[model samples]
Target: MEAKKNPRVDIYRLKNVFFNFGLMISISVVFAVFQYKTYENATVLDLGSLNKTTNEIIEIPPTTQPPPPPPKIQLPKIIEVANEELILEDLDLKLDIEMNEDTKIEQVTFEEDLETEPPEEEADKIFMIVEQDAAPVGGIKAFYAYVGDQLTDNYPTAAARMNIEGVVYIQFVVEKDGSITQVQAVKGIGGGCDELAIEVVKNSPKWNPAKQRGRAVRSRKVIPIRFILRQK
Candidate 1:
């Protein structure tokens, strides 16, 4: 016979009261653990060690060196020399040189010009009269004498006019009738002198015919016609 409980204080009311009481105990315990952890982790900060870091050194392999250059080439020298043995020695040899010397005189025959000549033996040996009568002097003198007067007269006037001084050698052939057949100047002294010499010979009179043995013959003669312009 307990005292009579209030009707309002039932099982439902007891359950609510117990649940609220447990919740309050659990919250208080969590708040205490957080405050203990924060207090244990607290420390002082060092500003000098804030920017510091560690440095490491690494080594690499070394490179190789290059080789040296090659040497230069040299040329040989040339020298000139003359051979003396070939120049001084003689190669050819000869024998048998006969020399004859006379000490004594034997005989000397002097022939004179025989006048009234002997009778010719051969027909070709005869001196024809016509050739003998034509140009008695058959040499170069005869040619000059025959043309001298003509040259002297004709060339003086021309030579004085031209003032040429030289000797012109004229070669001409005399005909059997004692006249100059052809005349040519072998040497000239220019300035109209050579032409004057030819003119002189061409104007010459008939000459004495030359004779070979007994026959008349034509002969060649060389005459030197001089043209000298006198200096006043």
Candidate 2:
């Protein structure tokens, strides 16, 4: 049989509405719980205690200095001196000479002094070029022979070992007395050849002094000495 159902008691028709209302209420509760916040109390500072600070003052002491010393005083000194006496003497002069027209005066003579020493002679000067040049007692050839003889016996061992061969130029001064002086080697090859040449020339015999205007003079002479190494 068909029966009339009560709209209020038929809960099936409102089931959807009940379910949607419950869903909305649950979402609102969940949102409220997530958005909740709690606050803590703030800390307070006491500025009244720090406002009563006192200012401190520092004091400096004064220093006392000693006074400077007084200046020194000096007294003047007095000296006594004796007075000296001066004596005066009288002088007498004679003026009683007489002159006549017949008086004859002897002739006055002024002779030169013969005892005075003559002016000193100047030192002998050396000449580079003279009218006649100095020569050895014998001849130039003879002089060279003498030199060779002197050097042959005492050949420098250094020169021979090194085979040094060259001419050594020797210079010497010939005095006014024809004696050889100031013998020196002007140019030479090394290896003791220069000293040997000088020694040989120094011992040479006297030469004829050079003449300049027929007067003997000191002169300079240069000669070349040959040094050769001989093979055995």
Candidate 3:
């Protein structure tokens, strides 16, 4: 017995069957895949509709710096004065019982301006207006009389007895009213002769008054008195 003949191979039917299976698998895979469209079933938010449609590319403005603030007002500078040392007050001194009770301390201030003037001269007038007083010629005479009366009895035994001739110079002031006030011996001779001479003039009468500027004024005068004792 011969080996059973192998079943007849249907190559065309096998090819047809494989082709149909591939086609069905491709269709099934395509259907199984998810399909999405961005425009499908879009939800529309309601906004107010306008008659015109516009698209604008707006240019943003650049930021600008504001002008610098006005320069700060400059006030004039004030200068401060320097401190000065305090001056102490002088003590109030009172030697007597009389003094002020309410004396207050005071500030010492000095002025910068002062002027000096020239001295004045008055040839006819004295330094101050002082009137002349009458000289005491009467008193001088009384003094002389007293001396003369005393000397008349005592001259012989006096210590001034001399033989030489001598002159005595005396200065006297004659007041404006024809009176003598002061008398002095400007020159004298040794011994009591000078005293005797002065005694004589002091006892003399009042003199005529001198005049200055045509007006009777007191004046100074010098007189010489002589005293001689004879030699025995």
Who wins the TM-score comparison? 2
lDDT of 3 by residue, 1-232 (tens): 8866445664565788899999999988887774533557878888877789788989999999999999999999999989999875896867676448686668898865467433433433321122443333456466446545655544433444444456678887765566665678889865676666666556666765554434556667676655545445
Over the stretch 1-232, how does candidate 2's per-residue lDDT look in tens digits? 9999989889899999999999999999999999999888988876675566787886869878888878777767777778878755674655775779987888999998989865533346778889999999988999989988877888899889888889999999999888989998889897999999998888889999998767788999999999877668
Model 3 weakest lDDT span, ten residues long: 121-130
| 2 or 3, greater by TM-score | 2
State which candidate has the highest lDDT.
2
Across 144-166, the per-residue lDDT of candidate 1 in tens digits comes to 67666565556656557867688
Q: What is the TM-score of each candidate against the true structure?
A: 0.36, 0.48, 0.33
Q: Rank the candidates by lDDT, best first.
A: 2, 1, 3
For candidate 3, what is the total of clashing residue pairs?
A: 0
Which residue pairs collide, candidate 2? none
Give the per-residue Cα lDDT of candidate 1 at 201. 77
Q: State how far residue 152 of model 2 sits from its true place (Å).
A: 1.4
Better of 1 and 3 by lDDT: 1
